[model samples]
Target: MALPVASPVVIRFGRLGDTVLLAPLLRKLHQRYGTPCRLVSLGECARTLYQGSADVAQVHWFASQHGWLWTNPRRLAVALALRSMREAPFYICEPDVRTRTKVRPMLALAGIAAEHCVFIEDIPLGEGEHWADWLLRFADLTPAAFAATPALDASRQLRAPSIRATPDELAEARAWLAAQGVDAAQPLVLLQPANKRTMRWNGVRAADDDDKSWPVSRWAKLASAILQWQPDAHVLLCGCAAEAGYLASIRAEAGLPRLLAPTGGLPLGLLRGLMELAHSMVSVDTGPAHLAAATGCPLVVLFGHRWPSMWVPRSASGSAVTVLGGLPHTPRVDQIGVEEVAQAWWRLPPRPVDIVPAAMGERRARVA
Candidate 1:
């Protein structure tokens, strides 16, 4: 019997950050077809991309066994399951050169014929094109929907475990602060000091010594300066628990107010809420920077290899500025000096006392 035709779309990237980066384009696909799209994903990123969107109706995991029939039972099981379910014309979207080679054979073994497969290689590299925009060129869709600002829809909203901090979670965060003898009344400034591998490849490369983050001594200096400018302002160091030592180093150097690593670990929703609550955020070109943009927080981002015009935050209500170095390859940490970062922060428009405050306060109240 012939199976029902499914709107076939496969994004083969394995990183959560990349999946989030591609979300706008995915939303565009949903808008254009008004059909639920299927996702073929692997690893932790499955959680990030499949946020229960009406558009993303189903998700299939990539099977690992390809060389031998019975070598890996799990891989075979996944493949057989997908085959028995249905077969449809499949499109493979590869935005990165590295992923293209890795994902080709995997798709082929899953009963996706070569003729039905579409490889993306035509997207041009330019000064002002976002990574999202560059990826969207692969799909048979218009750029208008891709360029359209994303609204806070059901899919985009952070689910309970990811970003939405529960009442218990919020109480825990406050309790932790109190235990440390730190005050929570003061507005929080979030500092995300690490950069992921792709971001490093395109922009800031990792430091050779101990695989530590880009020398955020400059960021520490700037944090101190912000506090000097506003003594009551408190800074919160945020990242995975694995980043706790790095946070400790920054805290020692900068004398930052409270260093809070999510004890239960940061789910995407809580991280978004943290960004939304922050008065501002200073980060390297990383996933947190992208997540921060979704919160409409005032952001000053430092761009190294990537162009600011293409990837800078795109919120209508908030202010954001990106400082870019004029280098084609990843910009060295030293190239982006503290003065440049401070200058960008200085340029942020002052938050309006009445209207803006009311809107933000309302959002906080709702979250509370």
Candidate 2:
């Protein structure tokens, strides 16, 4: 049976990886409904990544303050939802458990009955299933149907995750690279070494933060090794603008002053452009790895203790996005060696053409 094609909405909020991982679920929605969707998302960066999606019709950005519901009522969320989807018999999919509690109440306030909403808890949580697969389940897709869908393209995204930039944005990124002494002709290897690895709970022991990060020292070593292996390779160290000092420390620690550093405030769209142009990427489990994968960039993703089968980016056929993990059962990021990572770097095919030259090509390159 054909699902409704009009005014379907998906509500999701989390870090960049969570947004990127929504690719498969979004594709399933489009396949079932045969139309793009409206998205209710949070954060400017996540909004930037999904706003122009071919599978998503519109994105409603929700800003949550750090105070009482009275000051920022739950009604605000319902208004945001209704603004995108009115009384037109809409479908709502909420994938995150964290948001489920709040979203249910918001929908009730908007007078949406129970049947209209889809929650993760409603679906049977499969053991060791990838979250993307879990999302398909939440959408009521059968396993066989899930397998039949074009997962590679879908995992790339309903539209491939891109940092579509205007001419000025492209020039700005190129100029920054040039100023950092990056050779336009050489292979650019991007290094994303830092992440928001910890979040506090109850002002006590940090929860949901484990060893997903490779140390800065490890990153420095890996950067130096990459330089040694590819002498002409231009290395760009990337992080959120707030991590400028941290990125600098890695460069300083590696003692590679010529390493390119974009300003911390570089827009996410421009950053995606830079990723698309790069020869390859090396990072711990971070959002940029997933973004790089979307661009068809060869990547070596290091997992400290995270499950690669569950969390690694969707890669295309012949994708060099290698996943290196620690011992089975007890993964440790620090346990992974520089030599092991360097081997993965060596496995990547030679760098393709610099994207700066083909700056105006199709935003999503069909990864062959």
Candidate 3:
């Protein structure tokens, strides 16, 4: 008889972009162990990410206040929220030191046995190791395992993150795009101009960190150039609701009045479906860029704050080009120029003929 399968719990509490980076790790787990494991996360995007995901058994949302885990009610709340996973083995994937401190106490409170959990802190990531590699190592898996995992050999995993969208969601995206005057004939270029992590209020950023958002001025210039290069291209802005203000600023700054801004809000699933329809996406270092990569949409990503070695967006095969910050540790978006991004877009394999809207008839028929 086969031994009982272990039902592991995965813990990752990073926001949108971090969650996108986590995709490959989850895929490998699903390949190794066929069942979906429980995932614990704090990101709103996590729910949508794993909704139909074969890798996720269920998602537990844990809300913790800004104060330390040692505090009263906040600690108790976290403990209660995670009480369900007390009996299962946990794969703790959060890397930040502060998160590590909080996770241990929560596990103890939730009645989880100490031996049943594996923390990233147990075997800290080595110097220069990619985050995904760090995760595979955390699982005590061999390097050969990583090599054997399809789309993970070498750096192929970078382009291999995957997400599934429902038929209803695809219909909604197409309907919404049709309403917005986006047609199948022209190339749809998604321009994600907003980076919420770095935006400031009263000149104070939420965290004094840099996630590398390309400046709006440069984005406008790039938008103008894309239009010049691909005359039939339609530039559509995309981001979470929080980044609306910043997106509007880019729109005004770019002076492209014809840019399509879909009416009302677009949910994560709808946005993902739209990504599949897009010809190419040009994004600053952000979450939507990752979603685009999962759809295998041709992408050009601009990286400034984080090193590409640490957080470059991955896509299957050669679907993405990462432009890193030229300056040392504190590089600004200006470090990358519009010409370089346009050049990267130029290099993408001419959009495959079968993926074109005209050839998308079969998919559309299925949805119909």
RMSD of each: 7.4, 6.1, 5.6
Ranking by lDDT: 3, 2, 1
lDDT tens readout by residue for model 2, 1-368: 13243445677755677777776566667666567766666566656776556676666665672344346654376454564343323444455465566565556655664544455665765766767677766655322312433323334333233333445555766776777777566667888876566223332122235576566688888888888876777788887776777677778889875566656645677777677567788887888788777666778888876677677776432345788883365386667788888888877764343432374233223211
Candidate 2 off by > 4 Å: 1-5, 65-68, 73-98, 141-172, 198-210, 263-265, 316-318, 326-330, 350-368
C-alpha lDDT of all candidate models, in order = 0.55, 0.63, 0.66
Alpha-carbon deviation at 346 in model 3, angstroms:
2.3
Clashing pairs in 3: 158-314, 158-315, 159-314, 159-315, 159-316
Clashing pairs in 1: 162-267, 162-268, 162-269, 163-268, 163-269, 163-270, 164-269, 164-270, 203-305
Cα lDDT tens digits, model 3, 58-168, are 777655535656664644665676666555557788778877776777787787776666667767767666666677656544222123323324433332566646666
Strongest candidate by lDDT? 3
State how far residue 260 of model 1 sits from its true place (Å): 4.5
lDDT of 2 at 368: 15
TM-score of each: 0.71, 0.80, 0.82
- Global lDDT for candidate 1? 0.55
**Candidate 1 lDDT tens digits, 31-71:** 54455666766554455435555556676665442355346
Off by over 4 Å in 1: 1-4, 49-54, 59-89, 96-98, 122-128, 141-185, 197-213, 259-265, 309-319, 326-330, 350-368
